[model samples]
Target chain A: MYRQPVSRLWWLKKRTYFVFVMRELSCIFVAWFAVFLMVMVFAIGRGEASYQRFMDWAASPVVVAINIVALAFLVLHTMTWFVLTAHATPIRVGGRRVLAMREARVAGRIVPAATAVRVGGRQVPAAMVIASQYAGLVVVSAFIAWLVLR
Target chain B: MTKRHIEPIVWLLFSAGGVAAAVFLPILILLFGLAIPLGWVRPDYNYLDAVVSHWLTRLVLLGLLVVMLFHSAHRFRYTLHDGLQLRWEVPIAVLSYGGALLGSAAALLIVLTI
Candidate 1:
C-alpha cells in the first residue's frame, strides 16, 4: 500500500535540515559557476576583443550583484559541507580515531588559500595571498552594502 | 542492475563534484568576479587566454564539468524527491541523471570543438 506523503516543510523542522537544503541549493550556483567558466572559455576562444567584451559585461552592476549573492551562498555551502564531512567520514590511526576538526580546519583554511597561492604564483607570500582573499571578500561586501544603501 | 545499484555510483560522482566545487568555486569567483574587475588583480587577457587553451587545462575543465554536473544532478534529484515530496522516484532519477549526462556532453562538445 502507498503511504501518505510527508510535508514539503519537513526540512524546516530542524536547523540542520534547513542547512542541508541550503547546501543542496548551492548546487545551482555551482552550476552557474560552471556556465560562467564555459562562457569565459568561449570568449577566450573567440579571441581578444570578445574576451574584453565579456569582461566588461561581467563588470556590470547586475553581474556584480549576482556574484555577491552567489558568493554568500557559496560560503554557506562550503562551511556546511566541511561540517558535514567531518562527521560523515572519520579516519583512524593506530586504533585511535583522528580528529575530524583537523580535516575541517585544513579544508576551511588551506584549500581556499591555495587559490591565492596559485594567483600570486612565486612572487607573493602565502600570508599575503590569504589576506588578499579576505580583503577582496570585505571589499565586495562593502560595495554591495553601499549599493543597497545608496 | 537495479536502481539500488546506481545509487552508490551516482553518489561517488556527486561526492567528487562536491569536493571539487568546494575547493575551486570560491577562488574562481573571487578572482574573476570581484578581484579582477575591481582592479585587485589585473587580468592579463593574453596570458589568461593562453592558459585556457592549454591541453591540460581543457582536460581538467572537462573533468570539472562532468563531476559538477553529476553532483548537481544527484543533489537536485534528492531535492525534488524529498523536498518537494515527489513520489515518482524513477522518472525524477532518470530526468535528473539524464539531464546531467546531456549537460556533460554539451560541455565536451564546446571544449573539444572550440
Candidate 2:
C-alpha cells in the first residue's frame, strides 16, 4: 500500500499541530511536578535541615526559571483540557442534554406559530460546563491555599 | 476465560490524572515552586511538617502522585509514538507504565514512612 511520507518536523508545519505537540510535551512538566512533590515529601520526612536544603535548591535561579516555564505550559494544558471536556462529555440534566440550540422567535404575521411553541424547551449550554470547571479549579485552589497558608 | 484489554484501564487513568493535575498541580506548583521559594508566601516549617505528616494528607498525596505519574506515562507514550514517530510500541508501553509503577512504589514508601 502507498502512503504519504510524513516529515519528522510535521508538527511545526501548522499552528494547531504545533500547539497539539506542545500540549503533549506538557506531560513532562506534569511529571516534573509529581517528582517535585515526591522530593518535597521526602525532604519533609527527613528533618528541618533537609527541608531547608530542599527549599534552598528550589529557590535557585535555574529551578525557578524552569518552574516558571512549566507553569505556563501547565496553564495551557488546563485550559485546553477543560475546553476539550465540554465537547467530549455531553452533560445531562433531568434527562436532557446540554445543547447549542437557539431560542425560537416570532417575526410577524407570516411567521409560523410552531416557532413560538418551543419557548419552554430550556436546555443547559456548553459554556456552563466550561464555567463550572473553572469554578471547580478555583475552589480546589482555595482549599489548598487555606490548608497551607492558614 | 476471555482476555481483558488494558487500553481502557490506562486511558481511564490518563483522563482522571489529567483532571486531577489540571485542578491541583498549578496551585501547588505556584505555592511551593514560586511563591514560597521567592519569599512571597512565607511557609511555616512546623505547620507544614505537621500537615505533611498527617495520615489524611499523606493518603491524598499518594493518590495524586500515583495518578499523575500514570497520566504522564500514558501521555508521554503517545507523544513518543505519534509525535516522535517511535514505532516500538511494546517497549514504549512497558517503559512508560513500568516507570509509573516505580514512581508509585516510591510514593508509597515515602508517604508511608512520612
Every model: iRMSD: 8.8, 8.0
In candidate 1, what are the lDDT values of residues A1-150, reduced to their tens digit?
996666889888998778778878887888777778788788888988998888888899988888887788888876666545444443222333322212123211221111111222123333453454456546655653342223
Candidate 2 CAPRI assessment class: acceptable
Q: Model 2, chain A: how large is the TM-score?
A: 0.79
DockQ versus reference, model 1: 0.30
lDDT tens digits, residue span B1-114, model 2: 112367656766887788888999999999998998888988788899999999999999999899989989988987887777777978988899999999999999999998
CA RMSD of all predictions: 10.5, 9.9
State fnat for each of the candidate structures: 0.48, 0.74
- How well is each residue in A70-127 modelled by candidate 2, as lDDT tens digits? 8998998899888867755545555433333222221111211111112234434769
Off by over 4 Å in 2: A95-123, B1-4
Give the local distance difference test score of model 1: 0.69
Q: Model 1 Cα displacement at A106 (Å)?
A: 27
